[model samples]
Target: MTEVFFYHLQKQSLEAVLPGLLEKAIERGWRVVVEAGSRERLEALDAHLWTYREDSFLPHGTAGDAQAALQPILLTTAPDNPYGAAVRFLVDGAPFASAEGYERLVVIFDGNDRDALAAARDAWKRAKAAGHDSTYWQQSERGRWERKA
Candidate 1:
């Protein structure tokens, strides 16, 4: 079963935290797929990942990129996994219908958004009911991620 994790973004914006998480996944030698709700959001993220910080950037490509199969991190709006990713990230209210072939499924939602919170809760419930091991994580005041449930 795929392990599901909910990351409740409160103290930090997704831009502030996502690169680090992607780095960690890459460190683990995991291929990743990040799915967004819109093409504009996906395009923005594709650009951001290349220059998320002045010092370093996560190597990634969108589905339309050449040799997408070789990208360690892929960003796409498509419902299916294209890069044979081991981990999948659903952000910006992207719908997660299942986690069939992935090792991990991470759902990141902004705590300040009521709709995002509702959707995360629903995803949690569905994940639990499907027998997927699920955990909830929230950012601490100092901006470190802490597992809350």
Candidate 2:
């Protein structure tokens, strides 16, 4: 069964939080695919990942980039996993179908967005029904993630 993690964003924007998560994933030596809600979002994240910090870099590329397979992290708006990632991140309310091949699936949704929250709930139900191990995480007042469910 796939391990599914749901992150509810309330205090910070995805841009503020995603880089840290991606960095951790890279530290774990996990190939990753980050799926956004749109091409614009995907592209924006692609750029952010490059310049998020002055001293750090999260090596990644989009589907159109050359030698995409060599990238440690791949960004896309679709469900395609060209890099054969062990982890998939569904950001900005991106759709979730199945976690068939991935070792883990991370769903990051904006807590302020009713639609995103609803979608997360539905995804949770579906993942549970599919016998996946699921966890729900929410940001605390101190800006740390707390496992809520």
User: Weakest 10 consecutive residues, lDDT, candidate 1?
Assistant: 62-71
What TM-score would each prediction reach against the true structure?
0.96, 0.98
Candidate 2 per-residue lDDT over residues 39-89, each given as its tens digit: 999989988999999998889989888877899999988898877899999
* Shift of residue 136 alpha carbon in model 1, Å: 0.1
Instruction: Quote the positional error of residue 125 for candidate 1 in Å.
Output: 0.2
- The per-residue C-alpha lDDT of model 1 at residue 29 equals 98
Cα lDDT over the full model 1: 0.92
Please provide, for model 1 over 72-126, each residue's C-alpha lDDT reduced to its tens digit, 9 standing for 90 to 100. Answer: 9999998898668999999998997898899999999999999999999999999
lDDT of 1 at 64: 85
Local distance difference test, each candidate = 0.92, 0.93
Compute the lDDT of residue 43 as modeled in candidate 1: 88
CA-RMSD of model 2:
0.7
Clashing pairs in 2: none
